[model samples]
Target: MNLEWLKGIYVPILTPMKEDESVDFEKLRKQVNFIIDGGVHGILAHGSNSEFYMFEDDDYEEIFKVILEEVAGRVPVIMGIGAIRTSKCVKLAKLAERLGADAVAILQPMFLKPTDEELYYHFKTIADSVKELPTLLYNNPRIGYTLSSDLVERLARDVRNIVGIKDSSGDINQLLEFIRKTRDLKFKAFGGKDTLLYSSLNIGAVGGVCTTANIFPELVTSIYNTYVDGDLKESLELQFELNPVRMSMDKASFPVATKDMANINGMDVGKPIKPNHASPSGVVESMRKEMAKAGLLKG
Candidate 1:
């Protein structure tokens, strides 16, 4: 209910899987501690980086339960219940509410996706389903769907619970427009791409929903803290330092590359859920040098 905590680095925490690709709750616990101990503002469980689509039945609930229990109100936890099925997404949103998540972030249905009007109704239905839980519309164009600023403005204006959106597009103009359109509505806008964190802040974005923070929480949080403290020089320096890792991981298979960076940093994040999802050996090797260059290595 308290949205103020949204204004910092909220990690889209990875769902660590065992060798058979079953969810590794133990390692997941360690990851929660790593980020919490590392001092991130919040956690976003089951995000794309968390491999939400790879999940089977009950997989979503169990993983989310682990995260909710581990986080234990230490900070906010935003449950991601994105699905290609509209009804299924609503069910997951309700589940998040029942489980006491502070909020839920929804991904617009991907394949056979929706028209803009359908998208509006889809989000509206979910928001109406759980009026008490604040919803953040996720706009990641990489997925081949985007939540335009106009659509977001409409959601912010029409849905009381639809209080914000996360714009993954690295385009500053889109982010600025989202900011401008929702400025008077008290709606929150978050930068979804790690590379745009600093610029997002300068454009009046409250914070970042970043993938890189999964490994380097301190770096992401430092950017937010420094910028908020009026230290533009240090903030820009930190944001600049994070770019290589962001770009490097992006070249690989999402959270796989991200998880590999965690291992490079000495955290045992295990491998990604799918074997083919693994980053190429060369990519992993290159990530090591890049992670080190970004000063994200453990110890």
Candidate 2:
């Protein structure tokens, strides 16, 4: 398969839960259709928003099965394999590959903070172990461990199967540097921050894995499409219109606000995983107002 098929806005879809905290498969199916209908290029199952780390192995398998059946080839599905150990990650990756996932997105091992060399070997081993399956590196400094540009370049050069990166560090300069340093390499680069989508596209980044797209997939897709269509002015303006909701949502826990926005838009994506504080009434009200102002929600 063409690795470039993974390009464009990929939503790290949230796992909506029932009141008893079980995965709401019916609601999730609606969510998948909603995102596909809204024009996202692909969907990422069990990323940060999907609470992949919080789930047990059996739960992940079940959720993946549901996602695969729901999507059913409507669009490509990139599975998230963010296990704490590389062995478990490889296991999940193999499962995803066997189940016909388009690609696997992995974050660096957290907590232990492996050295650059360790990190390199970790990814190289996973890529090698997975063989032909394309892998995308997920770099989010806000989460704790940061993948350095040098290591990223090294991986791109050494690991042919490692196909792309999702840079969510929120630093446009760092993203630009990643693009600059890795330009000759075959790996695709994507923006992870919603606010920097425009600049990321301008600087040769392929697309985005944006949380904001959960609520405004069309608008986010418009930003990318407009830019690619050479309407930089319109794309930038859409980004400006989207900035308020993006900023507000970032101020709170991620999938919390994201699911709320999805619910407001008539998709019944349920609550975030436990231990996350419930979104305040005022915050939801403000988000509603901002969504209206951004034209994402009708008055």
Candidate 3:
């Protein structure tokens, strides 16, 4: 497959849920259009922000189907198959391929610290299971371990289908190393942190798998489009403007703030899944004020 089209802003879309925490297909479809129209180059259906671990295989297919249907070839879609078990990961990757996903992203297995060799087998097996869909390694250290650049290089060399990696380690040097090491291969490195989008591109990363794009895609896309358009000054200015809002998310619970911002902006994305309750009213109020100040919400 041609990996050239993979270069640009991609949103690890938030799964819209209802009061009971079930997938809201209606809202989900609308969101697919919301971001596409907002100028994102592509969409990630079951990304980390989508809460992939919370659903079953059948639920995964349903969510993937709705997103694919709504997207309808407007932009490439990558389905995230993030699971602790290799079997579940392969199963979801196959499901994504059957549903016509443009690619699959395997998030680092959580709760288990596998050795380098074991990690290689885990990712390679998933990539080998598919026929031709491009595969991306999601190196998120939040899972307790990181994919060393050496391991990433080995995968890129040995696996024909492993096309790229999303380095969410929040370490630019590590991301730079991945790019530097894989510079010759047909590999792409994407910045996984919202704060480092511009810098990532500056250092030769293809794009970013930014969570903030779930709320303000245009803001994030501008950073990519502007940079690509040869306006580094404007791109850096946009990135600076986005930093505060992205940083503020740390104040609220993980992932809740994305949904909260969507709802605050009247997207009505619904509450996060149960046990991961909505942000406190004060937190929500504070986020609202922050967004308004950022020009995301007009008071």
Candidate 4:
């Protein structure tokens, strides 16, 4: 396990689909290579941006295999196995471990509220199943319930392999509490929200896993690298510059806008898996403006 896993920007690599809505392995390879070449510390294959919910079990496994092979140890590939079912999550963890993923990130399954103990058992079972690989607890209450700071601390204490947590809540207090609780315990914290990237770092998070990076890798990664390089002024500058892009996205379907960025870059990663609407064409111009302002416009 890479103890220092949360060191820099990680892009949740998009699942490229051809016109038929099938997995585009060829485009996925290009997407992975493009982001790597553009400069990212890691790649997350089946995160929220990857539309993990839409993919079937066999297809999910196949996608992970493609990502792992494409990455080829160039950087750590953190596989997202955060399923709603405990037994299935355990099974998924085994698959991730077997397929050569560096780590697994699990989220609470579905939209039901569970007690702290239930959440504990849920994470514990998954960790125990893949005891050899490191586990990251994902705290994004919007999808499922948030992992309370106490629960996180308890998990860090008991789950020996639980090395980190990604907080997407956008709550500074919760993030600060997480950092405080886990610092001495040798646990790391990362940002799961792009909007909180700067502040999350200010409060001692190592880095982040963000969707915006899938669109503008250089610009998104600069926020972390510039801060780490000791130029706080430039780092904040980059963050503020991204505000319009984030604002524009707030009014639209998120992953849809994200795929728009990829398309603008000359790669058609397709739209978000259905039930949700595809991004409005208007959002693309707003994103383009932001990208151009940050000097990220494609040639």
lDDT of 3 by residue, 1-299 (tens): 77878989999999988888788999999999989998999998888788877887778789999999999999999988788899988888888888899999899889998899999999999999995989999998888889999999999999999999999999999999999999999999999999999999999999999998988989999999999999999999999999888887887887788888888888899988867988888988888777877898844
**Considering every candidate listed, which one attains the maximal TM-score?**
3
lDDT of each: 0.86, 0.85, 0.90, 0.84
Error of 3 at 253 (Å): 1.2
Question: Please, what is the TM-score per model?
Answer: 0.96, 0.96, 0.97, 0.95
Candidate 1 residue 38 C-alpha distance from true site, Å: 1.1
Per-residue lDDT tens digits of candidate 4, residues 1-299?
55865579998888988777889999899888888987999987788878888899889999999988888889999988768889999999999998888888888777778899898999999999989898998887677567889999999999998999888888889999999988898788998889888889999999999888887788789999999999999999999987677666675675677777777767777766777666667877777777677666777
Clashing pairs in 2: none
In model 4, the Cα lDDT at residue 158 comes to 94
Ten residues in a row with the worst lDDT in model 4? Answer: 246-255
Tens digit per residue, CA lDDT, model 1, 59-118: 888998988898888989999867877788889889999999888998877876667888
Q: What shift in Å separates residue 213 of candidate 2 from its native position after superposition?
A: 1.3
Model 1 residue 251 CA deviation in Å: 2.5
lDDT of 2 by residue, 1-299 (tens): 37758778999988888988888888888788888898999998988877887788888988888888999998889898787688888898899999888889888887777899998988888888888999999997856878889999989888888888999898888888888888997889999999989989988999999887877889999999999899999999999988888887755675678877777766667677788755887888888888888778853
Model 4 alpha-carbon miss at residue 4, Å: 2.6
Q: What residue runs in model 2 are displaced by over 4 Å at the alpha carbon? A: none
Candidate closer to the true structure by lDDT (higher is better), 1 or 2: 1
Q: Note the clash tally of each candidate.
A: 0, 0, 0, 2
